[model samples]
Target: MTHSRKILVTGADGFIGSHLTEALVRQGHDVKAFVLYNSFNTWGWLDQCAADIRGHFEVFSGDIRDPYGVRKAMEDCDRVLHLAALIAIPYSYHSPDTYVDTNIKGTLNVLQAARDLGVSKLVHTSTSEVYGTARYVPIDEKHPLQGQSPYSASKIGADQMALSFYRSFETPVSIIRPFNTYGPRQSARAIIPTVITQIASGKESIQLGSLHPTRDFNYIEDTVRGFIAMLESSNSIGEEINIGSNYEINIGDTVSMIAELMNRSVNIVSSDDRKRPEKSEVERLWADHSKAKNLLGWEPLYSGTEGLRKGLEKTIEWFTKPENLSRYKADLYNI
Candidate 1:
């Protein structure tokens, strides 16, 4: 099932995308990283990738919203992993139009190029946020997608657009729905990094939003492995698979565990600015990854509460480093 491929990973500049790009390069695949265009000529996290993979892969700077740029970056690439999108929920509140253009139309650009170029496979990234509040425990692919926030709604549009190509043009598209991936190089906007950065900054009291909501967190390594597994499996064509640790923990308990791991006695303070609107908040998410295991022969190595602790230990260790901790503004709330 393993073979050399010319792969293009859009949004390769971001957290998960950078890890995935490095993983692909180390696996001996020809990698083209399509990072967002910026005036500063920055490549997001890829600008700071490990020295071993510093020049191992190609970087294509462009905007996913541009069809011409997308097509150009995807040229001659056999596989495409679409990860670029407007992901911040709070920013989406007042700027929903940007989400539509980036998440929905941006995805359309990838689908169009994949269809026109006749790529071998296309893996579209989907978030657990699409499932919303989880109508039932251990949500699976069949669970109805509810776009509680503009970010989630846009992703739902993107997912349907990808699926539409498969049904209409028979594009080899596979959707990978990853639940709350966390680890090193993560943005402080996310809860895990938020807590780690705050505590690492010598804060006795942590500012958070809702502590009652629960999430199924997967380590970055596991999430990257899931993407590779999805790419390798022929059965993934036209299928949507969930990549998760299958372990649920409330935000409060997760913070407590992180504090214990860091050996810090910290107080959690609820911040209104960080909390989502009453209707927009995704209260719970618990993944049933049996489909991924049955289809792609993939499952999270970090698969339970014990696994979560191990993952957090590593995350804390990384974030506590002086060089890494200095990059984040722990005092500021990321909206």
Candidate 2:
């Protein structure tokens, strides 16, 4: 919204990407959406995007892993918001090579293009998972990064790749590391959707992994706003920032809140298979988003315990709807 520029959003078809694309279009930017190409020619979550912004943005179907395609997608765009990557940690365990190919190599492709193109701004997406388990409370931008999982490891490589571009070639780049983001259109691989989908499917008891791990959950709206804030702020260039609520809640408590919002009492059955390996499990994550506030003048409206519940309420309402609920297979455990 700072000044309408030709903006290309990579991963614009995914959960947060779709919402961000719609938001940019709402702000009247000349936006191009780079979605993964599939045989069905689907645009993922963007297919169900809000009605008003439909057709306002252009779509470029291609794979992020393809450097040639990615370079072509970045052409004619002044700013690039790179959010495409492999994010599922469980699936990372099943297939680490894909994480390397998609997360690491895919990110390299973006950095190379951004550096070569001299894009006005490039905001790269990072994850709280790269911090692994917190050795201290309120993990900040300065906190040590420990890649405990294959997914996190690849992201660490990607984050460093972006930063190296900034230091080495002086590419206009900033990394926005967001904590657990949950909302409508989220896949069942995520905890909030996994629980909600199961409950919506009339399951009295739910299977879950470690419940002791705490996360600083940020609602999808706040996350999208954080992305936009970084996009508009020149001070964010060449820096890594954390976007989170700064409030921590355990998984068990989160489940209880979700159940309360849904007006149901449910039992949580422990599932070892669903859990991360003993050493790889990220025991806790609480974000210190002070850098975000200082740099971008941004903070979460849906913050703290009360805000989490409100966000959950909004999420439950969407997931309970027949049309949206039908999209997920809640009975089968999504890796």
lDDT of 2 by residue, 1-335 (tens): 13336999999999999999999999988999999999998999999999998889999999999999999988788899999998988899889999999988999999998888878899999999999999998898888999999999999999999999999999999999999999999999889999999999999999998899998999999999999999999999999999999999999999999998889999999899889999999999999999999999999999988899899999999999999999999988898
Q: Provide the overall lDDT of each model, using Cα atoms, as 2-decimal numbers.
A: 0.94, 0.93
**TM-score list, all predictions:** 0.98, 0.98
Error of 1 at 312 (Å): 0.6
Off by over 4 Å in 2: 1-4
User: What CA RMSD would candidate 1 show?
Assistant: 2.0
Tell me model 1's lDDT, rounded to 2 decimals: 0.94
Clashes of 2: 0
- Write down the lDDT that model 2 would get: 0.93
RMSD of 2: 1.9
lDDT of 1 by residue, 243-281 (tens): 988899999999999999988899999989899999999
